[model samples]
Target: MTVPLFPLNSIVLPGGRIPLQLFEPRYLDMLTRCMKDGIGFVVVLLRDGAETGAVARFHPVGTYVRITDFQQLGNGLLGITVEGESKVAITRSWRQPDGLNMGEVEVLSEEAYAPVPETYAELTSVLVALCRHPVIQDLDMTVDYADARQVGWRLTELLPLDKQEKQRLVELRDPVERLSRLQELLEALESG
Candidate 1:
């Protein structure tokens, strides 16, 4: 399926929510079309270039996201909150005349449900503590502690991890593997 691409410096995994301030004509147009068509777009991390102006080079893997809520911010730019619905791989991409990037994508299958292992049980508690913060609470996230995917995605979202590291987590198709990778990162963070 072909979809509009919104390249950012960050990675948004499945079940993550991100708010974007849209001021560019290309993206504003894209938003209108997406909402009208009731179709979501792909959010990918940029490998090069900035979010505005020149067309950015983005990673092939991205999260297919749907707009969940929207509001008119005081600054006048359109504010929209989107939730990642599924992972997608961009097989091809091109820049439109308006500077919007479009991609021919394949939606990846959802990871099989795997329970959070006993060894990683402590990660769930860390996530619970992080969620109490006002910023996370504002997102109104629904987390399932028993699910390995949720634990990995939520931690990756809230942690101050590098973008490349987060991208690696997002690209992993296995929930257990993602959790194990996350544990390694957490350990590194603590030891360093």
Candidate 2:
């Protein structure tokens, strides 16, 4: 399942809302095409040497996202809402004529009901509290616990962490390991 690519330093979890400003010509073209085709694109993390047009350095794990809403901001900037649909891996990437990057992506799917560790339930409660904290309360959000197995991904994105840490979360395949790592992150944030 090849799809277009939109590289950012942020993690977008399934059922999450990511607002983006599209001003770059290539991305504008990508957005237009997505609207025309009724399809979405993969949101990947930009790795080292990205500015040099290095296609080989992007993170493999990404989220397949759909454009749920769009509004034209002044100065030709587009305010777009991206709703994550699924995970994907980058097979390849190429530069499009309009300057936006496109990629050959393979969508990844998890089992319908992967067992989540008991500890995750506790961690999730903490995360819910953190989301409601006064500092982050104005972020315009909601709590989605539809997939317990994906709670780690959602936390990784919600936390104000560095891109490297989020990338590590995306690469982790084991649910238990991912949950443990997320717990550690939350603990660290709480202590700080």
Candidate 3:
């Protein structure tokens, strides 16, 4: 699958909401095309591996984001809310004449036979408590473990975690491993 790329420093997890300001001409064109075709674009994390005036490097793993709401802001800026749909891997990237980055991508299917591990229940309880704490409750987060994969992605995105840490969480295929990582993070936060 080929996808128009939106490269940013922010992490967009599956089932998460991302609001973007599209002011660059190239991205404005990209958004126009996406809206016309009723298709989504890929949101990839920008890394510091590209030179000046060059296309920024992006993590291979990204999520398909559907535009939920869009409005034209003043001065040719666009405000849009995107909901992440699924994870994808970039196979190749190329530049368009308008300075937009496009990529050939493959959507990563959800783990076929994996079941939500028992540990997730405990982890979700802990996370809910953390969210309800007076200090952090204003963060306005919602925790739902009905779908473990979605929960994992939400946690990975919402936490003030670094890119490498988020990548590690994304790469973990086993539910148990993912739950363990969440538990460890929560514990560390509690003890710190």
Candidate 4:
């Protein structure tokens, strides 16, 4: 299914909720369309250029997301939250006259569930701490924390990593391996 593309300098893994503020005319229209049709959009990290100007280049892999909740902020910007649904790879993209990007993408499968090592079970406390950030805290409340793969993805979203690193973590097929890598990164951060 072709959906509108919203490129940003961020990565959102499946089940992650990313909040966005919409004010631009093109995106407002996109939002109107999404809310009307029950369609979502592909959010890809920017590889080059800006979100509002120029022919911005973006990573082909992205998260397919649907708007879940929204409210009007005091600033008058439409504050909306989108929850990641699945991964998608852009086959090609083009821009409309107003500079909004629309892409032909193929939806990818959910990351396969691999049994996480028991040692990483203690990481749940760390995740709870990470979720204290208001922006992310709500997104995970509904998840089954005992599910190790969900734990891995939650950590992936909370990590202080670059967009590319987060993208790599999201693309990892094995949740067990992803957890292992996340543990290593956490250790490095603590030691430093």
For candidate 1, write residues 150-191 as lDDT tens digits: 999899878889988888888888889988888888889989
User: Candidate 2 residues 1-192, lDDT tens each?
Assistant: 778878786768676767888876677778888899999998888775453234435688898999988999786778898888888888878876655677888877663555566767876776677777664464455655545555676677777877898888877766568788888887788899
Give per-residue CA lDDT, model 4, range 1-192, as digits (tens): 788999998877678888898888999999999999999999898888887767899888898998989999899999999888888999989999987999999988767665556788767778867778876666545655666778888888777876777778877878878878888888888898
Give Cα distance to truth, residue 173, candidate 1, Å. 1.2
- RMSD values, in order shown: 1.0, 3.2, 3.8, 1.7
TM-score of each model, in listed order: 0.97, 0.82, 0.81, 0.91
In order, the Cα lDDT scores of the candidates are: 0.91, 0.75, 0.75, 0.83
Q: Candidate 3, which ten residues in sequence have the lowest lDDT sum? A: 135-144
Give the alpha carbon lDDT tens digit for every residue of 53-75 in model 3. Answer: 46688788888899988888786
Best by lDDT: 1
Model 1 lDDT vs. the true structure?
A: 0.91
Kindly report which residue stretches of model 4 are placed more than 4 angstroms away from their true locations once superposed.
none
Stretches off by above 4 angstroms in model 3 are 49-54, 73-76, 112-122, 126-143
Per-residue lDDT of 40 in model 1: 95
Q: What lDDT score goes with residue 10 in model 4?
A: 80
